[model samples]
Every structure is written in structure tokens, then in C-alpha cells.
Target chain A: MRNQNTNILKATIKDIIVAFICIAIIFFTIYIVWGSEISLAISLVNKISIDTSKKVLEEVKLNSVTNKLESYPEYGTKYGTIKIDAINADLPLYYGDTLAILRNGVGQFSGGYFPGEGGTVVCMAHNSTKYLRELAKVTPGNKIIITTNYGEFTYEVFDTTIVPQTEMEALKIQNEEEMLVLYTCYPFNSIGHTTSRYITYSKLVDSKYF
Target chain B: MVKNIVSYIITMFLILFIIMIIVLNVFSNTILKKEYTIANLKTGNYYERINQNIVDGFKDYTVQSGLSDEVLEKIYSQDKLEQDINSMIESLYTGSKINIDTESIKENLLNNIEIELEKENKEIAQSEEEALTNYMEAIVEVYKNNVLYSEKVVEEIGTVLNKANNIINKAQIVIYLIPLVLVIILIVINHKQLKFLQYIGIGLLATGLFSITPKIISELKMDINNIMAINQATSNLIQTIAQDILNRFTVIGIIMIVIGIILIIIHNVKACRILEETKRSRH
Candidate 1:
């Protein structure tokens, strides 16, 4: 004889279909309300907060007086903008000299002094026309301007030297001058690689001295 | 009814996304893991690639390996020494098997010195062989100490790779099958109207193709040298391994897409038979 109670899974196909549709509706509602929408809302909130914090930091930089900036800037981090009116060369300056860093803008050597520190400040950039290609023509008595969050400094080129890259002694400070020594690979417009460096030596002309 | 339709469409999209996520998770856990990478290095053609890299960078290797300039002077010219090393490494693999042939290195060194001596048209001093032997011994000793000192590392990698490979192979089944079972359950629950199966089948097919995205992206040319800024040999090894992993993923994606299409066809044919049976019963 048949059992008095029916098995739970025993149902008409129609009944099961209705249950399936109901489950789908529940799942859809749950995801739309709590899953994707919630994540989107959270990301939007984070974006706004991050933007405001960045702006405040930028303001702090603009108003910084003769205080010292970080002695070491992290790699690929944009700390200042550099412009040389002589070559009309304008670009962002990063602290590290990885090939990638040089591609986007000038790369400052971490071992040197900042703009107003009164020691030799050394920097480098790619030898491309877009970068320091005009560096080939930067003669003595031309101006190189550096603008950072703290202050601005201008360097008037006094000497140009083409030396073997191994001879970086020219970059060293010989006296108490806030010097800006910038260099790039020599034969700046060469088809292939060159083993020399074209260097520009300039003493700090003026600054909101730090 | 419209709400139901909206619910149905949203659920379909959710199911599609879930399937994609689960498959990608499986890939991340298995293929992209360090264990898998280490295993791939050990078990694949990476060793040969490494050998080629070593040859291409022989001078740098000599300096980095701390071989003194005096010792380098004794070993013929730099280019000649480089050739000898390249030849030794070129004979490293026999078909698919790798025998580093490190044992034959001393013999190879003697042969090279003889070739170099002949090139200079030099008369052999009876003491020349002994002097050459001394230099050979120094070079071989340094090579073994510096380069082949990673036996412990290799052993550890072998153990880990074997364990991970086994787990990944088994988990591969679970990756696709769990989603398949979920789809089947839903299909059976809504058996009266199997139209949703058509959409789910297509979703599975799309998810399968998505599984091979790493391979697809790698084929695109982009200058990303800085992010991978490292020694050339190491970077080359990473690029090769990434390519290998993506190729494996492409095959997996193709397999999943085939299974999906088959499932959809079977469901549609079954639905047709059911519809015909209902009509027959009504008559």
C-alpha cells in the first residue's frame, strides 16, 4: 500500500517551476540590493575621500615655507615640475632614474641635494627631443627653472661638458654653491646607444631660499 | 510579469558572473600560484631558457659569479670562454629530459683550452697541461659552487610542485563541474520551461572563453619593461612561464565552450520531444 505521507521531492513539474522562479526573484533582489550596488557605493565614497585628501596635501605643498621636503622622494612619485625656457622643456620630476621614470619625465638622483640645500643638485632625463633633446643646444647663459610645492629656483647654465658616463666626478660639489647639474646620454640624437654623457652645470641663480 | 522577467534576466547575468568568477578563482589558485610557477620552472622548458639566458649573459655572469680578472685572463679570451660555456649548455637537454652535464664540465674545459692553444699556434710546454688543469679546476670549482648550489632549492620545489599539480588537476574537475551541477539543478527545477537553459548554456560558453583572458592579454604588445624591471634572464623566464600558463588556459577555455554548446543542444532537443509528446497526449 502507498504511504500516508508523500515524499518532499514528489511534486508536479508546474509546482517545481513556480518554486524555481520564486527563488530566482529572491536571489536577483538580494544581489541588486546588497551585492553589486553596495560595492559600487563604497568605491564611490572611497574615490571622493581620496580626492579631497590629495587636494589638501597639494595645498600644504603650495604653502610650505623654507621647511625641508622629504630628503628622499620615493621612485616614480612626482615631487615637482621643471621648465627650461631656453629649450622650452617642461616636464614633471621624479626622484628615481628607472628607464620607466625617464620615459614620463626627468628623473632626479636620490643622492643629491634638493633645489635650495646649497650643495650640488644632480638630475637626469631621457635624451629624446621630447625630453632633453633640446639639452644639446642649451648653451651657457640659458635658464633652467624648477617649480616645487615649496618654492621655485632658476639655474643659469655656465658650462657644458661631454664626458664618458663613468666619469660622474663632474656631478660632485666642489664649493658651497646650490648647483644644478643635469645630464643625459651623449650624442642625444644618435640612432643607437652611446657611451658618453652630455652635462649642463649651473649654480642656483635665485630661489625662495630654503 | 515584468518584474518576474527582470528578475529572470538579472539572475541569468548573476549566474554568468558567478561562473566567470569561480572559474577565474580556480585559475588564480592553481595556475597563478607560486607553487605552480615553481613547478613550471622545474618541469617545463624554463631550464633550457635559463641556459640560453646564461650563455647570452656570460661576461656579466663571470663578473657577478665573482670570478677574478686574473682567472679570467687564464681562460683564453672572453669571447672564446663564452663559446665554450655556450656549447656545454647547448648539450644540456636530451629530447625532453634535462641532464645538466655538469659532470663533463672538466673534460669540456680541457677540450676548449686545446682549441684555444692551437688557435695561437703555441708550442705546448710539458707543464702547459698541468697549468691548464689548474685553471680548469678553478673555473669548474667556481661554476659548481656558485651556480649549482641550489640543489636544496630544486628539491624543495619538486616536492611542492608535485603536491600542487596533483591538487590542481583534481580541482580542475570541481571548477567546471560545480557550475555545471548548479545549472543542471536549476534546469531540472524549471523543467516545464527549459528556455532558461539556452541562456545559461551561452553564459557558460562565454565564461569558458573568459578563462583564457591572460593568454589573450599577453599576446597584445605593450611596453611594460619597467614594471618587470629586473635582470634580463629572470624577466625572460617570467615572460616565458606566463606565456606557457596562458596557452594551457586557452585549451581549457576551448574545452568548456564545447561542453556548453553540447549542453544547450541537448536541452533544446529534449524540450522539442517533450513539446511533441504533450501535443500527442492532448489529441
Candidate 2:
């Protein structure tokens, strides 16, 4: 009877062990599968956010031109016509920059402007099929003639400065005579947003072209 | 002596099994749940911080453009929108408490922008062309900066959320597997407990079935609204699922105890029958 009871007890223990093994296998398999699903869900959420942001940006761009057209008349007189020979050229002009119309239809102006007031008018045109690259070769004393419908404005570059991006306040509008500042990203052929803006300050030498 | 030894071993096995169950349940329900919840809460807090950063950054941008209450309100609204998204995501991951749609938020934000732009455009049209152009330029500046800031915040939130999910998954696997392995060892050491084996199997099956039942029901009842209401609702659903799993374990525990009692009764009856047969043979 003692031996029989021992045998029964041992058998029961084995049965419990086997049951645990089965449970373990099932539980682990479920856990891994569920865990993977959760990970996939997270990835999905990220993708959705990125995709939505892109869509919104695209929509904003599409509406910008129309919005600008509706509000164009109040800002300034049609002082002069600015032209860029490059196809699909979209040149945005901030008021405080200068426009320099060069020979051969090439133009370069001060790229940086003051935030609030009209200080310098930077005008840019295509050089080698790019908007700002050709200005890289421009040196001091280069003549930038601006022919406004009212009058012709000519400026000669008197100073040049290589400034960091953060010193953008240096490009602020000055209170004295209208100063023309021309700039572009330095070291032509470099990729990415221009690290440094090449600045040239010029004064109105002549308004004969107008 | 042999009978005493066997009885001791059997008692030890039973005690171990009970202990293992208790440990697993406690870890799963309290420790693991708390870890995941804390992780989720931290993620939400980080999201809020990032949103605040974006708002602060935008306020600076607006200050540069010329400060306006309208711009401040717009920033506030955008911040609120971020909060809404964070809350929704939290709900989806942690519990089924609230439902919110990402699409609706997107639509609302877009409509708000459109309305503001239209109103500004109309005003500019009525005014001088120069003023309108200047106003448009300012709007363009604000919109561009806002978009850039929003994108960064979204990306950061995604990164944090991914980390949290990974942590939760790993915890689930580890916690669930440990008790299961322990139970297997218990069974292997007590080979005479065949009835216990059957009981444990039934217990696990019942637990799994109950745990997953609500999820299955939810899936069956899923609607388009759930997809759109993906943020807070998703977190809430996950929390609800966790609770369901905890409840299932409780049920499993009770069932195992009852089965153990029945097994003990059966074992006693079998012993009595064997003794009677022996007595008759001796006579």
C-alpha cells in the first residue's frame, strides 16, 4: 500500500508538470503574436501622422497663390516689373532687399532683409539654371541697375560680408538712404539650405534706367 | 515511511502550484499593469511637453511677425489639438475609455485655418493691395513655421510611443511565460497528479478564452468610427483588454482550486475502495 500510494503521487506530479508545459507553450505563442501586433499598430500610427502632415503641407502650398492674389493690391504700387528667365521660376521678394538687373538678363540682389520695414530690395534671377548660384562669382564694384517704372536705380557693391545664418538681424533695414544688400548661399554647388548668406551692400548710384 | 514521503511530496507540489499561480497573477495584474500604465503616462506627459515647446516656438515666430491675439489663439488651438491626439493615443493603448477620431481633428484644424485665411483674405481685398500683400506674407510665414513645428512634435511622439509599446510587449511575454514554465516543472515533478494536469490545462484554456473574448467581441463590433476615433479610444481599448485578462486569471484560479478539491476527493475514494478489496481477499 505504501509503494502504491508513492506511485500514484509521482504520477500525479508528472501530470501536473505536463499540464504546465502545455499552458506555457500556448501562453508564450499568444504573447509573441500579440506583441507583434502592438508593434505594427505603433508603426501604423507614425505613418499616418507623417502622411497627414505631407498632405496638409501640399494643400497649404496650393492655396497660397490664390490667397496672395486676393490681397495683392494693398501692399505697394506696381513700381517695377521683375523678371526671372528661368522656367517655373518662383522668386519670393521681401521688401527690404535690393534688385540688381545684370547684363544678359541675369540679376542679383541682397537676399537678406529686415523683418519689419522696407530697407533693401534683393532681386535675384537665374544663373546657370539656378536662382542664386551665379551670384557667387560677383565681386565688389559690380553694378546692379534697378529700373523702376518711376526711375532707374543703380548700385555699386561697396562692402561684402560672410555671415553666419544666425546673425540675420544684421540684414535689418537701416534708417538712412536705401541700401541694397545682395546675398546667396556661399560656396556654390553645395547642397542643402545655404549655410551662410553672402552679403553685399550697395547704395543707389543712379536712377537713370527708370 | 513511503506513504508519508509521498504525501509530503504531493503536498509540496500542491503548495508550489498555488504559489506559482498567485505570483503570476500578482505580477500580471499589479506589477506589469503598473509598468505599462506608467510608461503610457510618461509618454503622454512627454507629448504634452513637446506640444508646449512647439507652442512656445510658434509664439516666438508670431512675435517676430508682429504679435496678435489671433495668432495666440491659433497657437492655443493647435496645442489643444496636440493634447487631443495624445489623449486619444493613450486611450487606444491603455483602455477603452474614450473614443476620438484622428480624421476629425485633422478636418477641424484644416477648416479652422481655411476660415481664418478666408476672413483675412476678404479683409485684405477690401483694404489697399499693399496691406493685403503684407498680411498674406505674414500668414504664409506663420503657416510655414507652424507646419514645421507640428511635424517635429508628431515625429517625437511617435518615437516615444514605439518605445512604450515595445516595453509592454516584452513584459507581457516574460510575465506570462514564467508562471507557465513553473507550472510545467510542478507537473513534471508530481507525475502521479494526472488529474491536476487536466485541471491546469482546463484552467489555462478557460483563462485564455475569457481573456480574449472581449477583444473578439470588439473586433466583431468594429465600425468605421473606430478607425477615425483612433487616438484615445485605442488606448482605452488596450486598458480594457488588460483588465479582461486579469479577470480571466481570477476565474482560472477559482476553477483550479475547485478542481484540486475534486481530485483530492477522488483520490480518497480510490484508496478506500482498494482497502476494502484487500480485506475481502484476506477473508
Candidate 3:
């Protein structure tokens, strides 16, 4: 009886081992036949799986040698606040000019430069009451202060005008001088679509880098 | 021992055959079936989410366009939304040209804008004509992009889906026939000692483990909940489909394992009974 029981136990163990071996052999065969294709499929799926676990946005950095930024804030993220005492306006500033970014506060044109980069810093905001409703009221000599994570910049309004919304030349992005070009949809209180942009041009009057 | 080895080899083949069947059936029921994907999208509220996205997107444009919220109202009705979405999905399965019609939307938007302009007693000056056209085009683009998320890739995906569907349909008959032949061979080889039941059970057990392995590895290596896409709606759709497939795999694997264990237990009992009879006859 003891011998029979031992034999039965051994047979059961052998059956399980054989089962596992069979599985390994099947997988091995598949790997040999279609390993590259399987790898390609996995890699394709992995492309869409982003690692949001780590921080990707960093503080804006100015390179004194090139008069350009060594680092820039991630697009769509708030990097600073724009305050205009003349209009009682203070709003978050984002790096991108997407409509979504503009809805939140003010969006800086990605094609333009940062505050300390000695070039045009183009920004735009919605004309709603919560935002730049009093932007048109801002006149020459009014100060627009941009407080960024890296520095504080003050620009004095020198000119204001309404331009056709399609006028790209109105936004002069050059390295000759540090300028701030801010704009919003014109006819601020209108109940319908407006095809004009109310723009305010300012020259950098002060800068304090930290 | 040689006979025993042959039986083991036969059982191995049975396991492979069973795996193929499970895979084919899973694909046929889930990935290959257009209805399954459509059902998943409906259950996930994909259409409603897309509608909300469209509304929010329009609202964003309104901020910079100096347009009131009224211009966007009723641009596309919910019924139209459903129709377009369903039609797009049909195209995906049929490998048809994917075109989300935005002409009606553009016309409706133009009509709405005209009405707004008339109410405000404002006319588009010659200088502003280009801006107005650009604005209209931009709004239409937002609608088109939102309605058909990733349009170019979608066309490629449609082609792939159609090809896969065709291949699965053509290969299905052979997929079903192979396992039947393998099971018959397994029975013929192991029937003398009534060991076919044990071998079949072993095959089932192996198949169950193999079927469930992907879910196990995915759980360990991936954060399925954090699976993302170009936008939130697409992300939610992907996660929903992935979770559903994984759940199905787990359920099928558990069911096979239970059945396999029961068969093995029954075979052991029968073998014990036959052994006892032989012992009694010898005495």
C-alpha cells in the first residue's frame, strides 16, 4: 500500500512537470516564430503610454550670452502673473497661445520671447469682465508689470491701436528691444463676433532678475 | 515509458490546440466584432463626452472671437452627433473612406453668425473679411477634429481592422477544425487505459494558465488605470475596452481551470476503483 501511494504521488508530480514543459515548449515555439512581430506590437502600444509620474516642466531661464532663454516653461502651464495697475488686471500667464490657455488668463505667443530675452513678449487674454475687460482703458504711460518665476519686468505702454485680427505684422517679434505686445478681441462689449484686435504696445522700462 | 512519452506529447498538442481556440474565440467576440467596440463606446458615454468637448472647445474659441455663447447653440444636434459617430465606426469596420461631414456644421455656424451680426447691426468691413473667413474656418476645423479624433490614423486603423476581420473570418473554420481533430487523436491514444480524461484535464489546466498569464503580467507591469491617449475621451474609451477584455480573459480562465480540476478528480477516482477491482480478483 505504501509503495502504491508513493508511485501515485510520483506519477502526479511527473504529470505536472510534463504539463509545465508543454507550456514552455508552446511559448518557445511562438517566440521563435513571431518574436519580432510581437515586439513591434508591444512597442506600438507603449508609444501612447506616457510617464506622467515625473515632472516635465521647469522654470524659465535667460541666457545672457544669446539674449534667449536657456530653459522655458512647458506650454499651457502658468509661469508667471501679469499685473497692470492701470486696468486693475492681474492674471496668470501661460506660454502657449491656445484658446484654452487664453480662457484661463493670458497666453503668451510661443513664437515670441520670454520677459528677459530682450525681444517682443506677445500675450493675449479674453475681454470678459473676469479678465481684460478694462484693457482698452489702458493708455500711454500706464505700466504693465510681469512677475515671472525668474524675474520681474515692467513695461510702459507707449502705443495702443486696433488692428485687423489677421494682421500678423502688427506683432513685431524682434531682438532690437524688450517689448510687450498685449491684445484682446476688439469691441469688448459686443454681443457678436468681432474681427478686430485691440492691442497695447509697451517698452521694457525696468527689469529685476532673481 | 515510450507510450507514456507519446501520450504526454499528444497532451502537449491538445494544450496548444485549446489555446488557439480560446484566443480565436476571444478575438472573434471582442476585437473582431464591430458590435463589441460600439457597445463599449456607448457604455463608456463616449458620445456625450465628445459633445461636451465640442461645446467646451467652441466656448474657448468664443473667448478670443468676441462671439457670445449663442452663436454655438444648436450647431450640431445630439442626433447628428450619434449619426456621425456611428457612421464613422461603420466606415472603420468596412474600410470605407472616413469623412466626417462638416459642411452642414459650417453652414449652420455661418447662419448663426449672420443672425448675430444682424442683431448687433454690424457688418464685416473689407479689412476684416479675411479675419472672418479665418475664424469660420478655425471653428469648422475644431468641430472636424473633435468629431474625428486623429483622422489620418483613424483611416489607417480602419484598413487594419478590415484586414484583420477578413483574416479572422477566413481562418475561423480551420481554427475550429484543428482542435476537434486533436481531441480525437488524444482520445484514441489514451483510451485503452481510460487516461484520455486525465490528459484532457491536463490540457485544460495548461490552457487556463496560459490564457490568464497576460492579465497577470499586465497587472504587474502596467498601470491600466493610467492608460492615456491624445485626449480624455479617447483615453477613457481605450481603458474601458482594455478592462473589459482582461475581465473576460480572467473569467474564461477561471471557468476552464475549475472544469479541468473536476475532470482530473473524476479520472483519479475511476482509476482507483479499477485498481481495487484488480486487487480483489487477484486475492
Candidate 4:
């Protein structure tokens, strides 16, 4: 009886091994024949599968020595606030200058620099009563303060201009000096869209790092 | 012994063939079939959820335009959204040009904008007419894009799907024919000893395990439920489809494994009984 049981057990083990060998052969043959195609298919699927596990926002830090930021805020997310005492306007500031962002508060042009980066920082907001409608009242010498998670900086308005919306030169990004360019749709009270931008240029006057 | 080895080899080939059939059929039945996917979308409430997404998306634009949400009201009916989405999916499956009519949306928006302007006692100046046209066009564009996801992407997928269907149709003949030939050969070789059942059982067992392996690995490696799409509604639909596929694969695998195990057990019992009888006769 014991011998019979051992024989049966051995036979079953052999059957299992054979099954595994069959699987191995199938995989090996596929690898030999269609390996590249399979790999390409996998890579394509991976490309479209968005991995939302990655952080949507990261901690932003200003590098004082490099005159740059260690990390930047995610676009479309509010990272700071812009305040102009002259207009009594205090609004959230996002990194990307999209109309969607402007709907809520102010949006910084992603191409520009962060405060304390010693470069141009451009921001825009909708010309609504709640947003930058009072922006026209702001003149040169008025103060605009930007408060971020890392630091605080004050900018003194040096000039204001109305330029055609097509004039990209008015919002030029540079690194020579820390400047702030704030803009809104011109003719703030217009019922619909306007063709020009009201630009307020300011120079950095004070800074406080946290 | 040599004959036995050849039978096992044929059986291995048979198992590999069945696995291919399972994979191909799974794809053909679910993702490849336009009706199947459309059914999934309907059961998943994709239309209503996507409608809400479009509405929410428009809120941001309306706020920037200084228009009240009233302008968006009744601009896009749920029926219109459903019709457009279904048309887009049909185009994807049929490899056809997708043309979503934004005319209705554009007209509705213009009328609403005019109503809002009337309320404020303002007229669109001749100079501002271009801006108004652009604004209306932009809103219509947003509506179309939100409904279709991305036109270029959908068109490319439609093209690829057409090519794949052509290839699959041609391959189906060979995919089915070779397996039948292998099974016939296996039976002819093992018929005298009645050993064909054992080989077939072993083939099935291997195929079942092979089918289940990918599902197990995917579940361990990634969280399929949290798979993101362009928006929450689309994301939910994608997750549902993925889960359905995984569940189907698992069920098919289990069924194969169960049947395979039963056949193998029956063969083993018969072999054991024959051996015992032969021993008694020798004694």
C-alpha cells in the first residue's frame, strides 16, 4: 500500500512538472517570435496609463544663492497671494496664467520667475470687479506685495502701459533685475472681450525670507 | 517512450494554442466590440457623469467671461451630450471621421450671451463683435473637446482599430485551424492506450495557470481601481472596464482549471485501477 501511494505521488509530481515545462516552452517560443511586438504593446499602454500616484504638488523652496527656486508650484494650483494696497485687492495667485486660473484670482505666467529670483515675474487676472477691475487706479510708486509659502516681497510700481494684446514685448521675461508685471484685460468695464492689456510694471523694493 | 514524448509535445502545443484563443477572444468580445463598450458606458452612467463634468468645466470659463452660469443653462441638453458621445465612440470603432456638431452649442451660447447683455442694457459694439465671435467659438470648442476627449487621439485610435480588426480577421482562420489539427494528431497517437484524456487535462491545467498569471501580477503591481482618466467620470468608466476584464479573465481561468483538474483526476483513478488488476492477475 505504501509503495502504491508513493508511486501515485510521484506520478502527480511528474504531471505538475510537465505542466510547468509546457508553460516555459510557450513563453520561450513567444519570446523568440514576438518579443519586440509584445514589448512595444506594453510600452504603449504604459505611456497612456497616467500614474496619479506621483505628487500633484511639491514643497517649493527659494534658493537664495542660485537666485532660483528649488521647487516650483504645480501649474493650476494656488501657490501664493498678490496684494496691492492701492487697489485694496488681495487675491490668490496660481502658477499658470490660464483664463480658468484668472476666474478665481490671479495667475502668474509660468515663463517668469518666482519672487526673490531677481527676475521678471508676470501675473494676470480677469478685469472683473472682484479681481483687477481697480488695477487701472494703481499708478507708478504704488506698492504690490506678493506673499508666498517661502518668503515675502514688496514691489514698487514703476510704470503702467496699455498695449495691444498681440504685443508680447510688454511681458518680456528677463533676469537682470527683480521686476513684477501685472496685467488685466484693458477697458476693464467692457461687456465682452477686449483687444488690449493694461500692464503695470513694478520693481522689487523689499524682501523677507522665511 | 518516444511515442509518449511526442504526444506530450503535441499536447504542449495544444495548450499554447488555447491560451492564444482565450486572449484573442477576450479582446474581440470586450474591447473590440463597439456594442459591448457602449453597453459598459451606459451601465456606468457615463453620459450623465460626463455631462456634469462638461457643465463644471464651463463654470471656470463663464466666470472669466463675466457671464453668469445662466448663460450655460440649457445650452447642452443631456440628450445632446449622449448623442455626441455615442457618435464619437461609433467613429472610434468604425474608423470613421468624427464630426461633432458644435452649431447647436454655439447658437445657444450666442443667444444666452445676448440675453445677458440685454439685461445689462449693453450692445456688442462693431469693434467688439470679433471678440464676441471668438468667445463663442472658444466655448463651442470647449464643449466639443470635453465631449470627444481629444479628436486627434480618437482618430488615431480609430485608424489603429481598423487595422487590427483586419489582421485579426485574417489570423482567425490559422489560429483556430492549427489547434484543431494538433488535437486530432494527439488523439490518433494516444487512442490505443486511452491516454489522450491525460494529455488534454494537462494541457488545460497549464493554460488556466497561464491565463491567471497576468491578472495576479497586475493586481500586485498596480492599483487598477485608481487609474486616472481626463476627469472623474471618465476615470470611473475606465476603472469599471478594467475591473470587468480582470474579473472575466479570472472566471474563465478558474473554469478551465476546474475542468482540467477533474479530467486529470479521472485519468489517474483509471490508471491506478488498471495497475492493481494487473498485479492481481500476475499474483
Question: What's the true lDDT of residue B106 in model 2?
Answer: 34
Stronger candidate by TM-score (2 vs 3): 3
Q: Give DockQ per model, in order.
A: 0.03, 0.02, 0.32, 0.38
* Model 2 clash number: 63
Mark the 10 consecutive residues where model 1 chain B has the least summed lDDT.
B89-98
Worst 10 residues of 3 chain B by lDDT: B264-273
Local accuracy of candidate 3 as per-residue lDDT tens digits, B1-283: 8867877777787787777778777877886778998898788898898888888888887766656778888888898888878877887778666667788888998899899889988886675666667767777777777778766777888888778778878988887887788778878877865688788877887788777877886677566666788678889888877877888888888887778766665666567667877988999
Compared with the true structure, all predictions reach lDDT values of 0.57, 0.45, 0.81, 0.82
Deviation in Å, model 1, residue B156 alpha carbon? 8.3
- TM-score chain B for all models: 0.46, 0.34, 0.96, 0.95
Q: For candidate 2, what is the TM-score? A: 0.28
Give the TM-scores of the predictions, in the order they appear. Answer: 0.37, 0.28, 0.84, 0.91
Give the residue spans of candidate 4 off by over 4 A: A53-58, B170-174, B220-232
The 10-residue segment with the lowest total lDDT in model 3 chain A: A7-16
Native-to-model Cα distance after best TM-score fit, residue B164 in candidate 2, in Å: 22
Inter-residue clash pairs, candidate 4: none
lDDT (Cα, 0-100) at B97 in candidate 2: 36
Clashing pairs in 3: none
Error of 3 at B46 (Å): 0.7
Predicted candidate 4 versus true structure: per-residue lDDT over B1-283, tens digit per residue: 9988998888888997898788788888888889998998899888888876677667665655666779888987888888889899999999667778889888888889889889988877787777767667767777887789898889898888788788889999999999899888878888753577778878988898888876895676556676676877778887887777777788888888778777766666667767888999999
* Segments of candidate 2 deviating more than 4 angstroms: A1-9, A20-210, B1-47, B56-283
